[model samples]
Target: MSEAAFETEPVPDRERFEDASHVLHGPAGSAAWRQVLYALYVVALLSGLYGFTVTRAVVERYGQSWRAAGAVLPVAAGGAVLVVVLLVLAHLAGRRRGPVTPDPAWVDLVVASSVDRWLTLRESWLLPGLTLLVAGGLLGGVGGAALVGGGATGPVALPVGLGGGLLVGGALALSWLSGQVRADPSGPSRRGIGASLGSALRMRTALRGLGVDGLRAHSLRAARIGGATFTADTRSLRLEVAAPVSRGRRWRLHPGGRVRTLLRRDLLGLRRQPLLPVGGALLVLPGALAAGWVVAGDAPALVAVLGVFGLQLGAGLVAEGLRQHGDALGAPRLLGGSVRGQALAHSGAPALLLLLLGAPVAAVSAGALAGPVAAGAAVIAVLGIGAVVLAGLWLAAFRGQPPMGAFGPNGGPTTLLLWWAWPRVLSVAVGALVLVRLARLGAGEAGIGSVVLVALLLGVLLPVADSALTRAAAAHRG
Candidate 1:
């Protein structure tokens, strides 16, 4: 055919593209089926082991406690909270890496071509959707089994759990797809739960309407992010995920003392990124409540660990100043302050914010769990834990790139992950240990002297640890 005639010819349909893609990418053969079977086998094995070994014991212990306390309302409330959180998380994740994101090369070749997106990209959507559906059903079935075993519900709970979980998982998947659609700059402007659901139902049409330019850009960005993840380059991954500052530009910092100036700088940065502090508070509030419950001896040791993790994450969000300083540690002292002094200054805003946001919640939770008398102690414990966690974040922030040895033959991905996570692990471990010990001591009616001794020991250790980490961070920069 002549060049002009070929150019004017009608474009191939989605089916043609789909066939071409499958041929190009190679058809799934016996090896693929084998891998799928192996994965299913492993999952079944693990599920059986857990169901036989751990589920019964855990159900017996917590199920009785829950039933004794008339926990129907509490369980429902917790489930609601969990659902909201998961949905929100799913939306955020979709924005970052959507369910329909195929490889960038695939986008450049197949997706960018004149083909119906719904037909072309439907596989990507289907895989995640089916996975979520199955996983949710499994989880729900497990929960139902636990409830039945615990005598909290009848045998009818099994089907109900399975159905409920499937519905929830589908909802989550829809929310995720909605986030991806919303992230498209040229897409619809309407937003909210209704809009989200509508968009999810119409996702195929939505994808079709989305500009290839936007998809290509997002695909490229996602590709870069995936590369960073594969290489375990957290710094690059963080940079990739961080949105540019677009708010609070009108606000200016006034002249003040060095420490005050630094604190103000941190606050102003937070103002620009209002979500950071808001998200931090959201996490911190719940974490503090959990911590208070643990301290009041109303929750298990595992709760303390979870609480510590939440607090650590929350604190990390607000400690961007520390991270920035750590990133620039090797650079010249632009602020003309000592490293330790600057580190301390960077911590001030997070400390104040944590105390203001977390303390009241902790106090109230403690009061409710163990009477008003424990409220004051809970407040104290939160402050202490916050301080320790803040220091740990500093340590983590300053932990420069992993050493070369971490990726050596003897050391592997696990070692590298451990190296990167050591500071957070240590911090969580220490905080949980402290909270668990205090809970035990209170339950045992320990003497005031013992409490004071523990307090004094922590006081001495925290600063030393912080200082050491600060110096180490500086040295790494050097």
Candidate 2:
């Protein structure tokens, strides 16, 4: 089933990509078995958790530690049952492996086609989206249940469930749609292993200048026909196939004329970043203010919120400066460079300064603090915070390797903790200052030099100390 001639022709028709995606193409029996196993596994796992919790709590409440085994008899039995069910599942999956049952060749062909179709993601969008919708609905239900469990009226908000479902569902649907759009029209046909081998050999000749002595790519399924994979070779070279997915000129959309640059990238990836990784992150100005309200309360919360906005302004500046600085340094060698661009490049210092100045402006507006009195203090605090960020980045950049490995002899989790913890520590310090300031200023409180003076002293002290030590260390080495 070689696809050589199949691809040249256009498709005569396609059931809307959605129909193709959602519909089943596999043989009925295996499909049915997968459905049953999935359902059983999910039920067994969740029920197991509930049963364990109930039985344990009952045993503990009875005030008999040794005799509690008898009290949790039901839990023990349930656990045993779950183990048996899991074993049965493992056996079935094992059976799905090795040997083609009905005419080895036919079995091979069926398995190969099914596996390849999924791997390549060349199918209809509707199928995947429906699958995701059902999955998202179940997940949302669980989340809503938890929210309700916390004594809130979670069940009353149907919109939350529906919105969660659509957001997750629409995303999956769009992903499926994209696959369909990219899928080669003559996708179903197969090709010879010998030709695959030849292609591998040619690629080797081009890249490594080595003849392809042998190549092996584990297909993960014994396909009878219509799909194949070319894998492993002695050439360890990564062979990265890079190409531009986007192109643009930097332009700020912010009021300050600062282009967001590559801030969000594309529409799809608008909010896709692992910034804080685990959890507990604030997005932008609004989020910053909301978080302040929660943690700092009214008046000071307003100031804290403003301070966070300043941090964002600073971070954005640093980020933009890094980009332009790299460009100006002739990185990637894009040239016929502009003098105007260099003169007014996005610089980190300015962003940091704006944030520093803005924080006091935001807080002093309450008239609790005298504005003209504390200008120096606000500038000082900004400088200290900025220095912390710059120093942290510089250290990490210098280290330039994972915590623990051959190159990083002082590596491992310990190194990671020491090296990467700086940014977080700085954030905490800044957050604490804002939080404390708010507590001191209640709506009734008023002051001019008090807060401002403190900030100025810290600002001047930290940077001067940092520069002095850095210079000393360099001089000593030289």
Top-lDDT candidate index: 1
Residues 371-477 of candidate 2 have per-residue lDDT tens digits of: 33333333333444444444333332222223234234454445545554554455445544534443334432436654674466457544543453344334434
State every prediction's TM-score relative to the real structure: 0.87, 0.37
Q: TM-score: which candidate is best?
A: 1
**Residue 230 shift from truth in candidate 2, angstroms:** 24
Residue by residue across 297-396, what tens digits does model 1's lDDT show? 7575667888888888888888888878877777777768788888889998778876887778887888887877667777777777776787687777
Residue runs of model 2 more than 4 Å from their true location after superposition: 1-143, 154-283, 291-296, 299-320, 323-399, 405-422, 425-429, 442-478
What TM-score should be assigned to candidate 1?
0.87
Report the lDDT of model 2 for residue 140: 51
